[model samples]
Target: MQIMDVLAKLGGESGFALFFMQGGWKNLVMIIIAFVLLYLGIVKKFEPLLLVGIAFGCLLTNLSYFLGHGENALYHPEIWANFLDPQNTAAYHSYGYIMKNAGLLDFFYIGVKAGIYPSLIFMGVGAMTDFGPLLARPKSLLLGAAAQLGVFVAFFGAVLLGFTGPQAASIGIIGGADGPTAIFLTTKLAPELLGPIAIAAYSYMALIPMIQPPIMKALTNDKMRVVKMEQAREVSKTEKIVFPMVVATFVILLLPSTAPLIGCLMLGNLFKECGVTERLSDTVQNALMNIVTIFLATSVGATMVADNFLKLDTIKIVVLGLIAFAISTVGGLLGGIVMYKTSGGEINPLIGSAGVSAVPMAARVSQDVGRKYNKNNYLLMHAMGPNVAGVIGSAIAAGFLLSVFG
Candidate 1:
């Protein structure tokens, strides 16, 4: 009798027994999804730096749910739900309850909820970026602005599909092809959609090499792709130092909501260009960026609770995000084609495809495509103009959306 009692107790506590209880099937499904994401990040090397952490966070969060009835659970969506409820004044806009009752992942999530991680990531991006190409050719700004056509297009599409205004705005920003900007905007406008939006945004960004080439080919003829342009005039160090200050002041004054992202971005760039803060620039580029990326990716993934992520809305968001991203690429290419025609074939239309803010990746694609047509053609520096411009343009688009909906 004693032996049988011990065996029964063990069986009751086993994961096998628990697997059949408490909607464990949903957890199982989520665990499978986590494994797939892990495969993509590890084996396929798809944004491995962030996707790997995100996959692990998803795995940990789902596994913790198996012991959710006890204190062993690492995250609790109920706590966040209460925090988002304005009517629940005791829980709303306060972290006191969270501090007392939260778990490990919940603590990490604080940075994401408070909008710290993405803004800091922008600082790192600014520190690493070179704006000489942009200042050399201001026409690239128009290409970057044209790429934002997809942002508003996606916005209207989401609205027609039944999302609320804030939700639609969050969906629209994914078209910017900028992961940090998408996260920053979504957290403010639609935190509930953060998981899907972040996932979709980063996934599409990783697939830029595949998604952009087809669009580039379809939009332009070989002659336009092979066109070579004259070199831009040299930019002085004084101009480089002054550009960030002027941009930050003008943009922030025009759109006060843009202060956090724009201010941090310009500060990082200043640190790089001013030549007086090498150490600060280095830290922001390497240490600070890597640390925040881990925290941000994991915390964003923690929100992918089975109940929230495995829904029809997620499917819709994924489709809409793809459409938005694709359209943005098309818009940029069209802008390049226009420049080619207007410049009398002096500018390569392929450079316009780099205007989606994927940084050097999109610009490199332009170079590759241009080289295929004319071995002597060099579009990298030219493409960098629009590539960097896309960064500023996307931030501005996020600011505009926030002003309207946030």
Candidate 2:
């Protein structure tokens, strides 16, 4: 009788019982998805810097539902739900209560909830960026603005599909092909959609190499793609130092909502260009950036619980996000074509696609495509103009949307 009792107790607490009996089939599906994402990040090297952490987080969070109850679990959905509403004081209190009771993932999620990680990431981006190409060819700013056509286009599409205005706006910003900007905007406008929206934004961003090329080819003939731009003029150190301040002042005065993202961006740029704060700039670019990225990616992934992520809404978000990215690429390509004709074929139509703000990746694509046609043609520097401009343009677009809906 004693042996039978001990055997029954062990069977009740077995791993098989814990996994199969605790959570439903959805947990198994989510685990499979997590493993697929891990394969993409690890074996395929698809944005491994963030995707690995994200996949691991997803795996841990999903497994938590079955692994144990109470404090042993990595995430607690009931506790997290209370913190989703930013405007509710009681929700904030509940968040505090849950944080004290829950595991460590809840603590790290504060960065996502309070909107600190995106700003820090922007600071790192600014520290690493060079605005010399943009300063040399200010006309590239127009191409940046043109790429934002997709944001509004997707906004209307989302609204037509029956999403609320704030939700539509949050969904549309994914077209900007900017992860941090998308996260920043979605957190403000449609916090409920944060998980899907963020995943869509980063996933499309990683697939830029595959997505933009086909669009570029379909839109332009070989002659246009091969068009070579004149060498950009040299910008002085004084101009570099002054550009960030002027841009920050002008943008903040025009759209105060952009202050958090744009202000941190300019501050980081100032640290880099001033030539006096090398230590600060270095830290912001490397150490602080990596630390924040780990926290941001992991927390964002944790938000993808089986119930939230497996809905039809997530499928819609994925489709809409793809549409947004493709449209933005088309917008940039068309803008490049116009510039090419205006410059009498001196501008490469390929460079305009860089305006979608995938940063050096989009610009590098332009270079690769241009080189395919004319080996001597180098569009990298020229593409950089619109590449950086897209960053500012997306932030401004986010600001406008925030003002309207937030």
Candidate 3:
């Protein structure tokens, strides 16, 4: 068969054919990546729920053009049939035009493109979060602040690696270990890098247990790791009710740009804390959070088309993401050490992992590490103090970057 004839059988000449010729090789690469994400999420239980859905979502948009399904389709049944009849190519072109004119994810992606998904998520976070631990142990806030060292370090690293200032800022926020914060910053500063940054942030967050144990063990001795921390005092209900509002007002007053994330986050917490608002809080935390998570994950995953996501820059993002994670880990450990020294060695260093702001993941890792050294020590509660603080600290860092660069 002639080369041109062979090419014709693959998909027939047109934009789809050109797309295959241009992006087909990379499409296979992304499929392999999706399978890996699926395997990691499934067998390993690494963010199983999210990565599974997101992996399939990534594969969907990528495999679409190959099916001759046009730009966006929930279902596309024309694969071999488009090639068997050349007349159909022209016929489908007319249909594809109609679909394009109809508009699909173009609007959906706008929500992502404009930085709306993460803000909505922060609202849900406020509703679900328990600020009692943070309020009871304000010093843990320092650990959260220390964890952000990695963000600035990674920003510089990205710049050194040839990314522009705003792009580097977007990439570095991944080190904050805050997925929504990373997305929020990226959509504003470097939307082009959003797909890889979001995926990498969430992936590393899910991998926290695997990544942190060795680092914690390497930095801590048996006695220090085993050091028992005092249980946190039960926080007052009044304090919980007021904390989010105070923080939100503080952030909004000082840094209005940060209010989008902080305001929604605090408002959710307000509902959670307010005794009269259980029904509202429950809806915001459980129903609303889950729904937004589905939309956010699938929509973000849709952006991972092979042409956009499989560039040389994707490799750089992956590498930079690893750097961000590693640096954040180190920063957490250092914060633990600093706090331990400040308190004359009373503070357990494991709490430093919570500084990365992966919500409970890093905190859980701290608890596990403490348990390894002493079977009964429950550092999870204590680690939570720093864990939540990291969220605020990262937000502030994001704000700083925005203020300086925006």
Candidate 1 lDDT, 1-406, residue by residue in tens:
9999999998987656767887778888988999999999999998998899888888888888663553566878888888989999999978998888798999999999888999999999999999999999999999999888788899999999999999999999999988999999999999999888999998988998998999999999877877888999899999999999999999999998888899999999999999999999999999999999999999888888888898998998999998998899999999988988898888888888899998888899999988988999888999999999999899999999999999
Clash pairs detected, candidate 2:
none
Q: What are the per-residue Cα lDDT tens digits for candidate 2 across 1-406? A: 9999999998976544566674556777888998998899899887888888788788877777653343466777667656654675676647567667677777877787677999999999999999999999999998898888889899999999889999999999998888989988887788778778987888888899999999999999978876778998999999999999999999999999999889999999999999999999999999999999999888877877776788888888898999999999899889989998988888888988899998888899989988989999888999999999999999999999999999
Looking at candidate 3, what is the lDDT of residue 89? 59
Tens digit per residue, CA lDDT, model 3, 273-324? 8888889888988887787777677667766766678788888888888788
lDDT at 181, model 2 = 92
- Models 1 onward score TM values of 0.96, 0.94, 0.86
**Model 1 lDDT, full chain set:** 0.90
Off by over 4 Å in 3: 1-20, 66-103
TM-score of 2: 0.94
**Candidate 3, which ten residues in sequence have the lowest lDDT sum?**
75-84
Q: Highest TM-score among the candidates is held by which one?
A: 1
The backbone clash count of each candidate, in order, is: 0, 0, 3
Winning model by lDDT: 1
